[model samples]
Target: MHLRKLIPFIGLVGLCCACVFAQQPAATGLVDAARGRVAIPDPTKPPPLTNSVNDDQRRPRNYDMQPPTIPHRVDGYQIDKNFNKCMDCHARDKSAFTLAVPVSPTHYIDRDGKALQQISTRRYFCLQCHFAQEPVQPIVGNGFENVDALAKKAADASQAGKK
Candidate 1:
């Protein structure tokens, strides 16, 4: 009975110690991509908000299974438990008339893998998986290669090795 009463206190102390230890200086001199050189305890001034790219042109996906990015600005769009403004144009039944790409069929699948007539509650929040492109400079450089590019490079290397 006493151990059970003390368990919560012990867990709290352990969590505090873990947080302190986690903030110790990185031995590898790695800088946080988001915070840059600022220490963990220091407050960072956020960059100014940039305008979203609103050309309505679909950009290429960076990787496999990447959710499509919103091609238009979604400012002032209402997304709440009561309503989803995205469904106005992107719903399957309305996309043809609106000429907007329909929400993928996968969005209709429930956690149990059963198909629902409407968008699954789990996937109703479009912004959770999709983001509108912004024309802002990246804070950190990336050297990401898509699977298609990697596969083509491997094929070319094999052909060169045979020659």
Candidate 2:
């Protein structure tokens, strides 16, 4: 009957409204919007907008798109070892051997001009700023390709052609 259809339609409207206004509780009382008391958030829902991977799981910023992912797990590496795991691959001496780019020399310089022997404690937590890279999956419906990877391949091809 039409009444049955109306029941589902009414339920869907309520569900939508619930999602649209839900506010998290803080030390203060229930967060509320102008329209009504906000409904509870559903944990089953995928994260809402502005939610990307956790900051801990994500890579550093200010780099070109699609940097390679970190290969080793950093779970309990001796951070006291001068952020040593990261430094091993990303240091002035070992970068060439590890085939990894060293941390920028700027990272070694303190706010003062002097280069410190170790990574500053401020930069010691690798996950704080940098993260293992992730493969690029388009967030929207459109297909996109990374130009940098293509450019690198073209350069390699040109070099091979010359030889």
Candidate 3:
């Protein structure tokens, strides 16, 4: 009697194990296509660095709130905790001598709204907002238009209505 009950339980466990180990067909299409390509490049060799030409042309800001882009290359400009190379020319006192635009007055304001003699810790890293403007082909397409363009279109429509 004991063996008869034990045999059925053993058979059920064996059936479950067989189901778990049963081979399923490999996933097709996209999965197989992605698997054919190399996921990671060789780590031993460094990737080629592309040098972008510095145009030095000031691009008009799309909006008033946008930060001005850097007009020149900032290659090898040290901006560690101890120093910032941008301040050499853009500092309030240094701007007059170097002919570089002085950093904004807002850069001196602290988080608590207190003004400091030096650049605030919150705004010390210039690269956080300012990036070197480089002319390059867009990696993806966009249909973005600025507010000024929309306003001009509205104005033109209103003028046409009067005429």
Candidate 4:
């Protein structure tokens, strides 16, 4: 009947009205902290790109099992499926002539615990595990203590307690 059609139309309008009234206005000063005072609607200017560290001097690892960081800048280096520019200098045979540290022997091992003659497919991507540094202040402060420093502190505290 016409009444059944009118009932659905009335229910749709009620639902529309409920949805419109249910929305609360965004709270004042509820800005995103990550955007750093940038308004939600306004576009933010990106910071200038900083140069990567290119000194080539190796930095000490912060903890055990930490991957060594890239010492030189790798801008524009091709790292596609067809080519890996890093292998030119860092491959086992090439390292001797290039004076670049060779990729670790572990890189040649497969995920199944078997050794391969070349770098394993799983470990071929260098950037996934290592990063180059830039001379820029971190956005947030780091208070990370290395494993050695924490161990030394624990040793010192135990020595004092035994006294």
Candidate 5:
């Protein structure tokens, strides 16, 4: 008797499920459009390969702790285990003659804080920290404000509040 009642209940559930599934629309809008299209590259024309031009004009640092960007082109400048062309111009003794800013005195200190007569190997690679500035559009939008700008805004607000 119980089994006969359970059979009708199960049948009702299956019918409801079938109705729900039947009412669902076909996945045919964006998916169907994408499936019908073939993304083919232009075989006759090649994509342009352009090199970024370095900005020789010195740009001011946004913050005090920021590393200065290279103000000149550094392409083909050798910086390897055997040779560091940067030292030829930026070394302490050579800076006066070359008119290039010398590497920071801190670069002469080792990891243990021992001062060496020569630039510590830890800081030998100039390009590792200093990169040439290139004029290029930012890939993404940013509303970032510098520390000085933020500070000035706060100060201005405080002064207005006092008045």
Candidate 6:
């Protein structure tokens, strides 16, 4: 009976020790030794910048380039069992001759090479993979230039970089 009563106290002390050990400073001077403390630097290094891409950045090339970014705002768009905004334009049946941009041919193929005429229930939500965005103004400054025309320029750049 007495041992059972003491079990909670022992557990509490062990937990307190664990907390203290976790707070103790490391040998690396990056951490402060006293007050069981460490210091952290403010305003960490900025993320590396990628060159801005326009529609022209999409091109036919030997190797795959990065996927093009979504070009419009996607916030508050429904992308679930209840609704999907993307199909109004890109559905295989609707896009052709309907003033809708046709979906990529890749979208039609299933893993088994069968043409999945209907959007898979798993992929019913278009926003899961696609998003909309607008060009952001330069936050600070950069000298980067857009290739502006992907179909012709990508091959040259890739070839030049290789050589």
Best by TM-score: 1
Q: Scored by CA lDDT, what does every candidate get?
A: 0.89, 0.59, 0.78, 0.85, 0.77, 0.58
For every model shown, what is its TM-score relative to the native structure? 0.77, 0.40, 0.68, 0.74, 0.66, 0.41
By TM-score rank, best first, the candidates go: 1, 4, 3, 5, 6, 2
Per-residue alpha-carbon lDDT of candidate 6 for residues 1-163, written as tens digits (9 for 90 to 100): 6999999999999999877775554633334322224244443454554443435343333334434455544455666666666776668788875655566666666777777877765456565564444455545555644555564588889899999
Better of 1 and 4 by TM-score: 1
Highest lDDT scorer: 1
Worst 10-residue lDDT window, candidate 1? 21-30
TM-score: which is higher, 3 or 4? 4
Deviation from native of the Cα of residue 66 in model 2, angstroms: 12
Between which residue pairs do clashes occur in model 6?
A: 72-132, 72-133
Ranking by lDDT: 1, 4, 3, 5, 2, 6
Question: Tens digits of per-residue lDDT for model 4 on 1-163?
Answer: 6887799889999999877654422434444445666655788886887999999899999987899998899988898889999898899999889999999889999999899998899889889998889877777668999988999999999999999
Model 1 error, position 48 (Å):
0.6
Provide the RMSD of all predictions against the true structure, rounded to 1 decimal. 5.9, 15.3, 11.1, 8.4, 11.8, 12.3
| Model 2 agreement with the true structure over 1-163: per-residue lDDT tens digits | 6897799889999999776554335434544433134344433333334423434443443336433455445555565653467776777688789876677666677776788886655656566665544334443455444676678889999999999
After superposition, the stretches of candidate 5 with alpha carbons farther than 4 Å from their true spots are 1-55
lDDT of 6 at 110: 72
lDDT of 3 by residue, 1-163 (tens): 6898899899999999766554322332222232333333423332444554577677788887799887788999999888899998899999989988898899999999999999999998889998885465554567878998999999999999999
Of 1 and 4, which scores higher on lDDT? 1
lDDT of 1 by residue, 69-152 (tens): 999999989989888999989999999999999998899999999999999998988999999988887888888998899999
Q: How many clashing pairs per prediction, in order?
A: 0, 1, 0, 0, 0, 2
Q: List ranges where model 3 is wrong by over 4 Å.
A: 1-49
